[model samples]
Target chain A: MNINEIRNAARRNAGHVRRTPLLTSPFLDEIAGRQVYVKPECLQHTGSFKYRGAHNAISQLTTEQREFGVIAFSSGNHAQGIALAARQNQTPATIVMPSDAPQLKIDNTRALGAEVVLYDRESGDRDAIGAALAEERQLTLIKPFDNEAVIAGQGTIGLELANQAREEGIRNAQVLVPCGGGGLTAGVALALEHDAPDLTVHPVEPTGFDDVARSLHSDRIEANAQRTGSICDAIITPSPGQLTFPIMRRLCGAGIVVPDEDCLRAMAQAFTRLKLVIEPGGAIALAAALFHRHQIKGDAVIVVVSGGNVDAPVFTDALNRFA
Target chain B: MNINEIRNAARRNAGHVRRTPLLTSPFLDEIAGRQVYVKPECLQHTGSFKYRGAHNAISQLTTEQREFGVIAFSSGNHAQGIALAARQNQTPATIVMPSDAPQLKIDNTRALGAEVVLYDRESGDRDAIGAALAEERQLTLIKPFDNEAVIAGQGTIGLELANQAREEGIRNAQVLVPCGGGGLTAGVALALEHDAPDLTVHPVEPTGFDDVARSLHSDRIEANAQRTGSICDAIITPSPGQLTFPIMRRLCGAGIVVPDEDCLRAMAQAFTRLKLVIEPGGAIALAAALFHRHQIKGDAVIVVVSGGNVDAPVFTDALNRFA
Candidate 1:
């Protein structure tokens, strides 16, 4: 909600979350027709920025709360982030994931020492299951982004980015984020509002999953009509969260939606030029920065590549098609 | 030549170069059976560590020498590094590249504002050509590894690595470096000797092109029988440099040579686990750290991924086969 909360979250998340690099390349600059910087959160623990929020949320709990542990409903970056964050705090975690979710995500979450509760995607209500488990174990639910603590944690990235950008003499620019629930976007906007007001924040999403963007434009909460068909799956949430929507609507610029093709192309460019492995969902912000250059109004742009937990086949396909 | 030289190089390189992150992954640690930290120089400018040496060498040159210009004989990383460094310093650079070298490297060098003079790799004496060009233009030849300033530039990585290792509480570790003319290895070894003496340094090379290893073992420089056949071409110099070899001999531990298969596997691992794009040549140190775990000592191992400039086909093949 404020800079102080985000600053406190930074203190709690220190030594746990990685300070991902702000990567730059001349090739990317030429493509964008402007200076481009990438904050690669894919290099974060569990291969996403989700870890920052997860760790920060868990760190705020009381001693008894940590002992009883935490629970979450997800099967991707959020699942892994909670699993690692909980384990690191010596807290137990129960992740209620779809039975049909990718085996690798399930396995990786379990490997991170989480109690993985598999729910049938078609027949089971995951929220009910997670709620029941949390009640039984007295576990706190660490929402992916809606929770204040989580947003503050993700804002740590914004703090680091602001400081790093200033270090690079980037006094003013458009900061692009791959938005799903608008947690990162809101947190980044808040940090910039306090630290570097000259730099504006924009939420970029996949074409079909532009809920946050639509919500900002209409000055109201909006939901996506469809989410399953897009290749950019990581940031595919139903809509912006209750806590995150207000911040995003107040401080953010119009959202930039990029096609899956552009995300794939951005992935390939990141692979070959910057030597970074960015997943399609994670690469969407970069895609907008590169392909939607006409829409951006600045001499410089900074993009937060959200995550890199893509499957081998999908990654190979991206390279094969665009590299 | 010493820690002071490396310290000075870091000072000169402050704003001009990128201080690449020391990346770590749980998956990598699981594979190596130790706390593995990767110094991803692949993320450096020009997609390699050669930029450090190039910038350092250029910075130390007299104004007259810089105005007169500089030259180098390389078709890959060095050419690009020199080209970018020269451009940043407003110094004219002429890169004498082999005609058979990759077209991408040549074009990239030229794009960075370097004069590209291609010589026949099979017939034309590249040495003679480079010498002639340097003589006619009154250019200072920045040797790839043999020069003192260049080696000191590479040593800056060692200083950073030592500091990062301590930050992670890794006091004792084996630092594996992908060895070519031993510039990086020697630089890192010298830095570790002064800063983190408990961290032993090792030169990791491809099996057949183990010239530095052989030279170290025999107490004399030993040339590789063949260099053109190795996929690890970025680190396939004939032998260790005269300046670098002595430092490596005194400060480095026994060499660890891994197979080409291991290098490819390491590249895939880096891609999938660490979200890093590493070339086979650059992945050699990681390969040695992962596959040759038994040969290493201590509970921690640090590897410097030297570069990431592999062609797409080669990268795709690596992902297809090992990812």
Candidate 2:
């Protein structure tokens, strides 16, 4: 909820969440004409920054709540994150997923010691099932982005980015964050705005699902018709959450929309030049900086690569399309 | 070189050599019934452990040698390592690469501010071209391995491994090292043998080019005149270098050979389970452990994932094959 709370949460979850290396790319620097640094969340536990929030939130739960178990509704990174967090906390977690979720994600979630409950999105809503399960079992429902603890946990990444920038001697630079439901962006903006106010914060989203950008433009929480075929499957949220959107609207400077092709190109560039494997959603900020270089300031830029839990076949296919 | 000298060299090059994470793998543990930890060299600069040795060797060059520049002959990670090291040292570098070397590798070397001289391996030897270039340009030839400076530099990985093992409370464990010209294995073995004498060290090689194994068995360097195609491009060296072979023979507790299929499987497992993009050569040690799980010591084990700079098409094909 607050910057200090986020910092404390991050400190508590330090050992659990990987302090993933913030790598500099000589090739990316040449392309952007700026000092480009990548915070690889792909290298994090469960292959995303979602692990940070999930772990931090789960770690701070009441013993009674943890004993009753936790419920999460996600078709991707959040499912795996909650699964892994529950496993680490020695608590049971039930993850509700759409039947059409990527098998890789399902398998990873199950592998991390979470019970998977699947529902068809066309026929039923997974959130309803998750809520029902929580009510029936008196389980604690962990909202992916709307909850205070979740936002605070995600904010830890911003704390890390600010520290990394300071350590790297980057006095003033823009931090690009990818927004799905604005959880990551809200957390990053909250930390940067409080501590490193001089550091500009940019939240990146896909063109089709640029609710954050729309909200910034209209000064209202704008919602679009639920749609899902973006290359960046992880950040395909139809709209920002009530809790996260307000924080993002206040703390974020501006939002940028990157094309699907830009996401593919950035994924390719990450694989080849940065020697990193980033999922499309994880690479949206990188894509923006690469293709939308004109929008960025020619100073030190830190891009938070949100996650890397991409299915191998899907990742290779993306690379092929870009190639 | 003595262990103390190599340790000092590693300490000197610590700032340049990334302290790659010793990643834990519960999946690997479940499969092998032994706690499996991976020392991720794939995440290192230049995408391999060669960077440590190359940078160590180049940085220690005398003022006269630095002015004259450096020359290296390799078609893989070593070329990129030397090129980047020389460039960072602000010294000119002429890399003599095979004409058929991966274009990506060539491009990366050139990008690092190295002048590449392509030579036809069929018509002439790469080492001969490198020798000529060094003589013509008055540059020092930085051998990929088989040199005291290079071995000392490569030993840094071993030092890091020791620290990682200590941090993880792994007092005694079996450590697997991928062997090519035996430079890496020799360095790692020397460091481990000296620092952690309780640790067991195993050298793994391709079934086709088990030069270190053969040399260790014969108690002398053995050249395999029969050149066979190895799926692992990085470890296709037909024979072990004289300098490295002796050290490997003295230090390695055992040697093992893994098939191409095992390497491919290991690479797939690494990509999917570990969320890492390790090249075939980098996955051989993992392959040896996974395929030879029955033979390895029934204790905690560490696998040195050597490098991750596979050609795009080849890597795609490998992923497809395993998929």
Best by TM-score: 1
Q: In model 1, where do residues sit more than 4 Å from their true spots?
A: A99-103, A118-124, B99-103, B120-124
Q: Could you give candidate 1's per-residue lDDT for residues A1-323 as a string of tens digits?
A: 79999999999998888998898999999999999999999999989999999998987789999989999877578899999988888999989887766565788899999989897755787778888888888989988889998899899989999899889899779999999898888888998899989999999989888898889889999998864667776777889999999999889999999999999899999988888888888999999999999989889999999998887778778888988
Q: Distance (Å) between predicted and true CA of B82, model 1? A: 0.3
Cα lDDT of model 2 by residue, B154-242, tens digit: 88888888887887789678889888888888888889888877777888888878877888888988876544467677777868897
A54-134 per-residue lDDT for model 2 (tens digits): 988899889999898999988679999999899889899999887777788899899888999998866787667877899
Q: Residue A183, candidate 2: how far off, in angstroms? A: 1.5
lDDT (0 to 1) per candidate: 0.88, 0.83
Error of 1 at A49 (Å): 0.8
DockQ of 2: 0.53
Q: When only chain A is evaluated, what TM-score does every model earn?
A: 0.96, 0.96
User: In Å, what is the interface RMSD of model 1?
Assistant: 1.0
Tens digit per residue, CA lDDT, model 1, B122-144: 67888898888888889999999
For each model in turn, which proportion of the native inter-chain contacts is also found?
Answer: 0.84, 0.36
